[model samples]
Target chain A: MKLTILGCYAATPRSFTNPTSQVLEVKNHLFLIDCGEGTQMQLRRNKIKFSKIRHIFISHLHGDHFYGLVGLISTFRLLNREKELHVYGPKGIKEIITLQLKLANSWTNFPLLFHELNSKEPQLLFEDSAVMVKTIPLKHRIYTNGFLFQEKPGERKLLINEAVKYNIDVSLYNSLKKGKDVVSEDGELIENHLVTADPPPPKSYAFCSDTVFDPDIVPQIKHVNALYHESTFLESEMDLAFPTKHSTAKQAATIAKLASVKKLILGHYSTRYTDINLFRQEAETIFPNVDLADDGAEIIVE
Target chain B: MKLTILGCYAATPRSFTNPTSQVLEVKNHLFLIDCGEGTQMQLRRNKIKFSKIRHIFISHLHGDHFYGLVGLISTFRLLNREKELHVYGPKGIKEIITLQLKLANSWTNFPLLFHELNSKEPQLLFEDSAVMVKTIPLKHRIYTNGFLFQEKPGERKLLINEAVKYNIDVSLYNSLKKGKDVVSEDGELIENHLVTADPPPPKSYAFCSDTVFDPDIVPQIKHVNALYHESTFLESEMDLAFPTKHSTAKQAATIAKLASVKKLILGHYSTRYTDINLFRQEAETIFPNVDLADDGAEIIVE
Candidate 1:
């Protein structure tokens, strides 16, 4: 699994920095998260194929989080896209996008789908044979949700030599990989474990941003392979962070330590802080594994 | 009058090229016109003072023309703006803007006033002691209007040396500047023309974009000091231009020639064309005075 950060700044986008937006690639799926303004340009700058984005997950209704959405939808229609696009966001997201399309009198020719979400509890958002996605309800000034992406456990690996030693027929290899006991040609039952080995462990990523220091989410995202949490301010600015319902670097590190995530990626930095390394230094005091997310930075999940 | 081209390219914004948006400074007032995506960053790149912009004029509801507006508005609130902002655009603009603000629950602390226009004929949009703005109806795929920013004729300049030579009292200089004949302290009648000269001819600029080669605007924008016209295609692509309701370079020059504009500025070039100079060459064939608008190019109206 790999993740690309298109933008990681807080508040407004500036000439040198952008707002929140990123792309997560897992199991051949590219999922776009929090399309802030200038995301399409950032996508182009990073050479990411626009066609690869089939699903977009929005965390909230803040302009910095989802303002680029309508423009992207319009560009898709302009480019003659025919594939259906799915959007998962807050409840009012559909109304906001449809209103702009209606006013411009430029409706999409392709099928546009919107999955409005306003639930306060964790709920499954999407699931397929290879992967599954669910919400991690977050505490913010507004109704918000972070998404959890996980790769489903795969079928057991077939041990070809062991299967042959067990006198298993080639046609029954599929059943053996399915962890089922198979009857040999001589009417002898062969245990599936004798002919197959365990597959590689699956990986998971949890995305949580624009939220306060709420421990409620720690249990939901516990022990994820990677966790991206918002660090909008430093511990020195704790006074500003709480009233604004944002998290400081120390608070984010505390959450990371409590959840026991393999790695913590810090992002959504307030532009006022000139030195981002200060966050990493502060976070490392509590959490040993900390990574700072910069625009265009990519992380490979291990 | 000074005009800064923040972005002039047509269609979607790319890493190098931007969509429609510009900054016009006339009579000490800064006005933002057609805020496409990334406009705020463009404004910062251009070193424009955000507080000076009290008015924004949108040509149409197309994504490329006004997608950046809401973000700019939201940024104003985040920056703690206290001044009132007036936005003039098509009829549905209010609903489009208000809906997003409502959904985000980020109403601006400053007053935001919207002026919706649906007139088929010319209408006055704004006026002050120094400048006046009006709408120029244009034929496009949607209800669109071009803006005419004209500096109201100023009070006649008081020629200080001439005024002293005419023996005009200091107290009467204001009257002399107002084009009033004044009685000198020596009991001599001084004609206003003898002491004062006409102020620099009131300069005017017409912004016409995202429209086809419609001649109906010729009479309205006739003889303006500078006219910025959309040239989205070349003469070779006239077929596409007409179908898409856009104009070619040659067609834009034809309108400029017909309107007898003092100078013609061509912009909104289609990004498909690598050579923008071709637009200038084609336009120069029809009009003697032509200027090509680049993303950061600035023009001074003389």
Candidate 2:
């Protein structure tokens, strides 16, 4: 699993900093989260393949989160894309997009499916054999949601050298790799554990942004391989955190400490502060494994 | 008169090139036409005083034509702007924007007025003492209209040096500038032509884009100071122009020639071609005073 940060600034799009958006690659799927203005350009800058994006998850209806969505969709149609796109967002996205396409008289040749999310509780938005995505309820000024990407359990690996020395039949290798006991020709029961070794551990990532520090989300994102939380303000401006429903570096670190995540990545900074190292310093004071999320930064889960 | 091309590339937005958008400065008034994505950034790059922009005219509901409008409006509110913005666009723009704001529970502090154009026939949408913008009917996939921005006849100039040497009275100067003879305080009739000269001939700019080569609009934009028309295809690809409701470089020049326009500016080139000089050459074959539109390219009409 890997996460690529396309943009991380909060509020509005700027020349240097962008709004909220990212690409999360899990197993075989690429998920786009929270497309802001100039997001398509940012994606091109970061060398992201547009055709690989199959599923999109939006947090809320704020302009900073999803204003670039319509343009991206239109570009897809203009490129004569035939792949089907699945969109999951809050209510009103469907009407806003469909109405524009209808007014312009430019309908897509492909299929566009929208799943308007209006529920208040955590729910599963997408799931497949390799990965599953569940919504993590967040506290914001409006109806919002964060995504959790979890990888399914992988199959065990077989030790080829051990299997050859033990004279294991090639036809029974599949069953042996699945942790099954096989009966030999002499009616002797052979254990599969001796021939198979452990496979790599599956990793998961959680994305939480444009929200205040809510301790209740600890249980939902517990033990995630990586957690990306918004740090819109620094410790000096912590007073503005509660009123704006945003999180400061210290507050995000506190949540990271409470959740006990594997690693903490901070992003969605305010434009007032030019030096971003202050965020890492403030976060590292409480959470030692915290890192600042910069544009084009990639984090690998291993 | 000056024209600032913000984004003129056709189809979609890229990391460097942008989509269809421009700002025309005529008679000390800033009029924006067809705002696309990254337009606010383009305005910043061009050093345009965005606060002076009080009127925005959109040709159609295509995302590239008007996706940046909501972000621009939101930025105005953030800047604490007090000017009342008037937007003339196709129908459904108001509903799409207002509904998004409603869902986010954020409303603008300044006044935003909307003039939805759903009519098929040509009509006058806005007119002031210095400028008049009338819709020029065009053939397109959508209900698109071309905008003719003509500077109203300005006040006649007083030829300051000549008037001073002739000892013209201040009161008579004002009347002469209005093209009327007035009796001086010395009981002498001062002729308007003797004291004042005609003001620099009022100039005009006609913007027609996202449409095919429809001769019906030729008379509406005839003999303007300058014309910026869309050239989405090259002469070789004229076969594809009719199907897409777009025009080739030669076709656009044909209309410019028939209308007897002084200068023709070709833009909105298809993204398939990397070299844009061909478009200029193609149009110049028919119209000598032709130029290609590039990002941040300024055209001065004197």
Q: Which of the numbered candidates is closest to the native, going by highest lDDT? A: 1
TM for every model, in the order presented, reads 0.97, 0.97
lDDT of 1 by residue, B68-147 (tens): 99999999999999999999999989998898898887799999999999998999999999999999898889999999
- Runs in model 2 deviating more than 4 A are A184-188
lDDT of each: 0.93, 0.87
How much is the lDDT of residue B86 in candidate 2? 94
Among all windows of 10 consecutive residues in model 2 chain B, the one with the lowest summed lDDT is: B162-171
Clashes of each: 0, 0
